[model samples]
Target: MELTITSQKKTIQANVLQLHLYQQSKVIEAMDKRNNYYYVVFYQDQFINVVKPTHMKRHSHVQRAITNGISLPGDHPLVNKLIGQQTLSMTRFNQLFKKLQQHYPPLETALILSFFDSFTTAGSIPKLIKKTYYDFRRNGKMRKALQALYLLKEVDAQNTFANDLIGKMEFQKYNEAYQTLDIIMEKDPVYFEDICFRHLQDGIYHENLLMFYDQKNRHIDAIMVLLYLLKQQFNETHWQQLQATIQTWNNEAQIIVLSDLYRDQPHPIIEKELTGRLIGSSHHNEVVSFLLEQNYLPTQTEMDKIIDHLNHTDRSQLIQYFHQSKEKFATLRQSITKNQLEKAITPFIKAFLSTYSFEEINQWFRAFHESNELFLIEQTIHTMEKLQDDPDHQDKLGELYASLDQVEQAIDCYKWEMELHPQNTKAIQAVAHLYKEMGNETEAGTYQDLLIQTQKYG
Candidate 1:
């Protein structure tokens, strides 16, 4: 029968030492795999040498292997070097060869040669292999052949030696993995879920996460269950229960649990909750709409609190509210800033400029400019566009443009305003004043001509 290990159904209780050792070994192995090729031996507190396969380059054979997926027959120099070394153990030598086979293709000759330099007179084979295994595992390579011996009881399993080996391991590796997994989960929830699903069979996957959600320490089971449901594409009803469960878990100061799960299974629930809260306030619709566009799902109560603060509070209250809930308010505040400026012109035009007359809308624009509201700014600009035909409105537009520091556009608007009221001395003088400021002698002369004509006509 095939062995099936499901974390949910089975208890993954590992002994403290064994769990620590197994984890430490994984760390050392990972390091060896990525960095140095050989396991290092230290003698008298000094680095002795590395133990790795040694083979002289045999190009003709290598080229043949590349082309055919099999090496061509050639004399392996390592085998010849090892034949003279009668001190080499055939048992250990053979074991090394099999281990190399698991990663690289056949290289029996090189394995024997590697042993001539690599092997040291360690007290016990199992203890030595365990030490070497941890070293290699930490370094990031599979010393599976040596590892298999330990598992198969081919090597010694004495606690005194094994425990000594385990204690020597660098805790940094385990700590680093925990930190790394934490970061990966926090930054990307979907990726976390993928990792969990990919390694579902490995009890160690649960073991690693259990650091954050250990029942005896701080139970985050409900949060994990919620995240698992999200990972499994749990429907609305399940998500609702998960929400309740998470709230209960939250009461225990266990945010790490939620954070871990979020890193693995970021879903659309956040935006959904925010939208529910945003509908309560008409002004907040812009904020809600922005969140919706970004596909953000704020938690329900979080959104409700935001809406309540924004709609019913004084300026001091608003500042205090956001200051206290920085995480939730950060995105909302940013969205407000972006939308405020943009919403003003577009929505204002739709609200007033399309149907309202210039004179009638001027008071609204004044209120908008005084308020410095983003929606009102857009509306004032739109209202100005509607009054393009009126001399007073045109002068107001010119003043508005000048106040905004669009000097060139403001000058143009002043000229246009003069054209609308050629008889008005102030309008004609304003054009001449702008032309003079701009150092446009020719344009200034033209404005002089307009002023003369306006004075004569009036």
Candidate 2:
């Protein structure tokens, strides 16, 4: 019976760490590598050192293995280095060589797995390896000799055989054999890409193929696969895999991918995460725009985060979001710092004047005045002056001016109201009262007389 890779996982899980100690027992490529070689360790299919991958290139061998497929010959120096160590002449290990020759014309993946199964320690079965090498040479089966030679090496051999199998195995055959997450976890990420490329050849896609790219941390390829999955009929398992993959990334990494996901579809998970990431991220303008475009309103606190970082260019988006949102802005006012409110003042005023009742804007300005935000009140009055210029409604501007103690401006607005409607007693009285308050007795008596005349005419 052939061993299924998933069913016998404990044996697979504890294989040699694949990092080798090199040049004075310092671990290097295919081992617990440190500074000496360019070893890329992965977790959840993503590289452990993503930020400075180029900085890792001290040796070309590992980079080459990762970029270009590995296919080492029997006499390669790396191969020789691998088998140089000694081990017992074990019968079981030698049988691996027989299985390879018997199945040599088309070496099977099951036979390939046996090599890893027999593996015990470094050089654990080199005696069998040497016998196999000599037998293959004697039998003139040099390629099988190389396959025997590969048994001494671990990851590189798995990589080499997997590359060869790509050319020979049908895609589904390879996918059936190796696409399981447990099986994928143990193999080189490059092999997974090869199989994905094969699957793409037919223009047929499965969201589950994300396992090859997403789980393996094949960054560029992962994006293409993720986009495809986004377009397919929604699948919970597919989305869960995508979410789990993103959960591993740093905020910076998450933002770039999430932006792409958001563009392709408006899933709530995508919108929520993209909204969160874009705010404090370098893409703050995006957060503002994203919030505006989204149907679900962000809480006042969430909007304030963007307001705190507001730049001149994003103000328009803020204005767009604020349209008709008085209650939201009112809540934002209590917690917004002075500087943040200042930065967002233009948008806030535009929103208020556009949606606020004529009386409501004056009340809002009074709240600003009480807070000692005189500048904000002035800005609102200025915007209202340009946008809501109704001669009949000078009372609104007069009230704001009076609240600010701009008595002369308040008197001028009330006088304008008196001129626009001579029969209006309230504006004439307001003018007389403000003049008296300003100690201008002449203007006070003049407006008081004008008020009496207007009332007499009415």
Candidate 3:
């Protein structure tokens, strides 16, 4: 008899196990028990092995053909059918199983089940899954591995052994481990939390996690994780990068988080720096309101730092607020001294000047000069010099210089203004008066003639 072995689209012939059931019929009938009888003999490549009759009960035709000494190919359908029953000896079973595993699709559920069944211990299931997963992964067969993992997960939904393998496969295949994490989280949130904590503790996938959190708009959670990381490891460069990221967010949540961190950590320098950043952000008013509600009074330097970061309109508004608050104004004014007046107090003084009348500003200037604050007087003169085109400002400066006993300088100021505005009777007369004070009668007479000539022309 011949056995037809089909492999894919091809057929071949080989020697298969054959049994003479009639020859053993009398012995099988005469025996008290037929269960222990080995009725068939397999012949392959001049090698022979005995097979049990019960093994082929499911394939009766193949059993009858085997009883007639059939010839079958190595990849015969009967051979595969017999192997699929898992009734062969351990050595032959493993050899045939390995052959099928090597030739068949790795992700085929039947093949996977056959390979899994070959393992004697339940503990080895995870190992088999892991090996199969890596085999597919090594071959760049991500889809196959994912399918295998899904199967393994179905088998053991709480398989902690396969979690890491699945995670790695998902990460490599999808460039994200969250798919695996989500699955794990859904199955066991505590386990997921522990895994995440371990990853964070190991400093693994932190940046990816942060990016994922940001993409999901979980910035507060991301910041909390960053803070935890900083507390655990304290990486200066990483901390700075995190700070820069926080600043880029520049939202109310970030400000609140930073503020809470400051409250908890009590790092005044960091607090001030964070507050300065907040004041510079679009949520500046919100942050300020929060601070005020918390009864947090920023120091003069802190306020100045914030003011320096404001725009022109915001700075004006802030200064107006300061002007209205006597205590706040006093605190601002305490930072101003004669020596540091120009550098430290110029902005404040300018803001004040914008809010007051020119007469009021002049009164302040007179008070500063009378108090022997030479630096303040010099600053006032410098500010007035910027307005030299304004004859009124130039005249004011000239009178100031004359009051300081600077006769030549005052005279030069009037003459400079008269040069700019040749038709100004005030400048011309001032220059003439200064020349008379210096006892230069000829120069005074010259200016008086020029003034009369100007009047005649008019």
Candidate 4:
């Protein structure tokens, strides 16, 4: 005789106990009563232990099933106890009840049950949740816990779990929050609008991300995350709202986001609409910013629009904005693979130098120059050389040449320029004066000869 007990494997069974239980098959055996427990010989030759149907100790099996952390075992009293009790912390309750299994644990159910009990009585779950959040955060469990906690909404539980999630922002915990979101997006697959809303409320959303960039001011990560969000699907309202937000970002921070829409979106009509709405600005500074920050080489039509916009804005304001925007542009420009600056950076440098004095231009380039930002170094030198005729420009021009290891060229540049403008008495006297002061007797004698020669020729 054999026992069919596939699901009953864990009960105190060795091969010998199975043989003894099986040997009694189909016999009218004596019922042994030990304390109030009963045993019977079954047709399959197994000794079955039974408790009275209404007995309290039957709860041990019921509790076993419940504590196993699957669905509640049917009609069990411990179900109420498990669901009702707020006495145990989520972690501890799971440990005590054997819910925290070795592999593929019932973590979700445990967290939900604990959250149910925690939020069951409280009017304000904020502080508890906030504390729970930090605990999960500190333990590196936020990602696992968030997916579990998010399911509580499905249970129609009385808790503000989602709201609490949106409000917490420890700097150390932000990466965890980001990882949690990545998991939710992959696992749950919510609607486009819903994700957008969640992202917006999280304050770590796509368009509004640069506050961190400004705080950390590490523009590369900032722009990378910004681009990553734009690549995601956005519904109509969020798409437009984000467009407007990017438009204003372009205005305020000189960061451009909409051109990425063209890269990812296929519909020409959508592209045209984005072109008209967000990147349509004709202002040279604005257009140059869009081109430089986003690596967008404006099409001829776009270039025309920029030229037109420049007509409307004050030239001085454009110059001022151009100066202000270079720091941000340099931050992005340094990491780029291709030198897109030939058209974009060179024109801005030319425009900036053609109008602003060298002192003002140098002041604008000062931060990036000092930091030795690689992308704009050549452009800065070229712009400085172009602006060299300005009265206060000599020292900076000398500085630029000295930086290039062309110290002799720098000295000669000043001397030749003064020679070309001898009528500006300062230039003439400056050369004779500086050569004599420097004890360059031969150079001083040559300048004196030139002065005498000029008088005789006159």
What do the candidate models score in CA lDDT, each in turn? Answer: 0.39, 0.48, 0.49, 0.41
| Candidate order, TM-score descending | 2, 3, 1, 4
Worst 10 residues of 4 by lDDT: 15-24
Best by lDDT: 3
Better model by TM-score: candidate 2 vs candidate 4: 2
Highest TM-score: give the candidate number.
Answer: 2
Report how far off residue 311 is in candidate 4 (Å): 11
Model 2 clashing residue pairs (backbone): 18-30, 18-31, 19-30, 19-31, 19-32, 20-31, 45-215, 45-216, 45-217
Q: Per model, state how many residue pairs clash.
A: 28, 9, 8, 3
Which segments of candidate 1 are over 4 A away from where they belong? 1-198, 201-269, 272-292, 295-393, 399-412, 415-458
Candidate 2, residue 404: the lDDT equals 50
Candidate 4 ranges with C-alpha deviation above 4 Å: 1-231, 234-271, 277-286, 292-299, 307-458
What does candidate 3's lDDT look like per residue over 158-192, in tens digits?
76755556676354644343357655444433234
- The predicted structure with the larger lDDT, 1 or 4, is 4
For 1-458, candidate 2 gives per-residue lDDT tens digits of: 00101111221111122322211111113211233222222222212220113333322323433333222222222222333332212123355446545644332322232223223334334444546656766888654554444433333344454345334433334345354534543543333333444354233333334454455444433444445556444456656666775676677667766665666577776677677777767666666565445554555567567765554334454556544333444445676666555555545554444354646655655555654656655565665466347786887778776765557777778778767877778888888899899899998999889878768878
Candidate 4, residue 139: the lDDT equals 81
